[model samples]
Target: MKNGIEIMNVEQTFNGKKVLNGINVKIEKGEIFGLLGPSGAGKTTLIKILTGQLKQTEGKAEILGKDARKLTGEDYKKIGIMMDNFGLYERLSCFDNLKLFAKIYEITDDEISGILKEVGLLEAKKALAMNLSKGMRNRLQLARVLMLKPNILFLDEPTSGLDPATVDAIHGLIENERQKGTTIFLTTHNMAEAEKLCDNVALLNEGKIVEYGNPKELCRKYNHQKKIKLHLYDGQNIELEHDKSVAKILNRYFEQGLVETIHSTEPDLELVFMELTGRKLDK
Candidate 1:
């Protein structure tokens, strides 16, 4: 579990106001690490510092074993970024826009075609950027990021404001990249999305990490009730608390072979977060 990204007591300030407060995190190589928080939780600011787009006022950030503040142009080539507003030439056709980025990266036409096909945008390659649907536009942005075959990807709310199907499509693409061994740094308030894509997650609140771990582990950690609902094959159900008495009853039921389904009353990520942070999701 080598460290791919590390933030060591990182702090940031803007206009004399503190934005991040002693944040510490470590993401292993080839892991989909999620920074989950509501808007204004300093997730984006931290990401910018990690990407070398902004320098932190205090502390350090390390990416791929290189100090983020000292990252060179070649290091930038190994990482791709898709922020809330990934650039695209609205007046240009999809192909032309890709051509411009390809030229910047010194990629060939054949490579561009391959990227287009990978993102399912080959048929609409010649379509004007303004003419493509929102989903198509997202795919086009993804295609541009793929030109460098980036080893690490930073995605900020990649599926925000899209329809369900489009979100699923984008998630599928992201999963494909992860399968190919790309380390992903994801910032989003979508808990469900984090649970689906992340191998580990950090709960950011008011510029601090209140919790961090694998999603299921965090959820289980805060499951204080310790109750389970058993649905019997005969259509009867029983609720049992966690204690020696209930354990004996559960074992008896199992011995009688009446159990069909067992539902544990485990708190979900949201509940765990709310319990920890004393807050809920944004709106």
Candidate 2:
């Protein structure tokens, strides 16, 4: 609440239909919080409400101790948002596109160059936005936002439709921001991304949060099977409950050099989401 984001019983309606329902969450300072759900799950709508783009139909939302609905221009300056590539100027070079925002934020040329390098876009700084690849365009957009050096960053599906390598690069950049103490609010259906990047996540479904907690802890909490799966050198596999009864068998296999690998049957975020919502996180 002091230096982070808080939403209390927030709800939203479009026309006569409700989109968000009784959503509540608290994100700590310098934490990466993920709002995860499939398409049409109101992830974007919740972001809009928090960012002051759209007011919630009911309840309160606050960022950095100020009411979201009353956030001023100065308050906005402390926030960076990269929701889409629509902010890019197709005719302008990447450098020029960033320069436009630089002027508005009073950022120096050296800082702009530094950000370009940081986002791995320095070499393509002079390339037109329209001519850049999708990945490069995404980086440029991220650069524009990072130039502000905002305390809070809102990234909605930052790596959607990107290749694995590019997604990794983007993830690295997000981690870099996290190291600098930026509070990141990310909305993605990618459960792997959430597990990799978030300190905590809220699983949203049908405009409501069905689950919320640390990603790894949530997975462990729902590990109903609690089995230890083992693969043997002889191409045989075995699963045993994580109980004292199986401890002797596990040790015997190890002593006999038959175990090749072992893993706990911990459910991942996708599986947990499915179990709770009866729907896949991707769909």
The residue-by-residue lDDT of candidate 2 on 1-283, one tens digit each, is: 6789999999999997888999989999999999999999999999899999988999999998999999899998999989963568999999999999899999999999999999999999899998998899889989988999999999989999999999999999999999999999999999999999999999999999999999999999999999999999999999999987988999899999999999999999999999999999999
Summarize candidate 1's per-residue lDDT along 57-170 as a digit string, tens digits. Answer: 999999978889998988888888888776689899988989997898899999999988888888899999989887888888888886788888998888878899889989
- Models, CA RMSD each: 2.4, 0.9
Per-residue lDDT, model 1, residue 25, is: 88
TM-score of each: 0.90, 0.98
Candidate 1, which ten residues in sequence have the lowest lDDT sum? 1-10
Query: In candidate 1, residue 5 scores what lDDT?
Result: 90
Off-target runs (Cα >4 Å) in candidate 1 are: 1-3, 231-237, 244-261
> Candidate 2 — number of clashing residue pairs?
0
- Which candidate gets the maximum TM-score versus the true structure? 2
Candidate-wise lDDT, in order? 0.88, 0.94
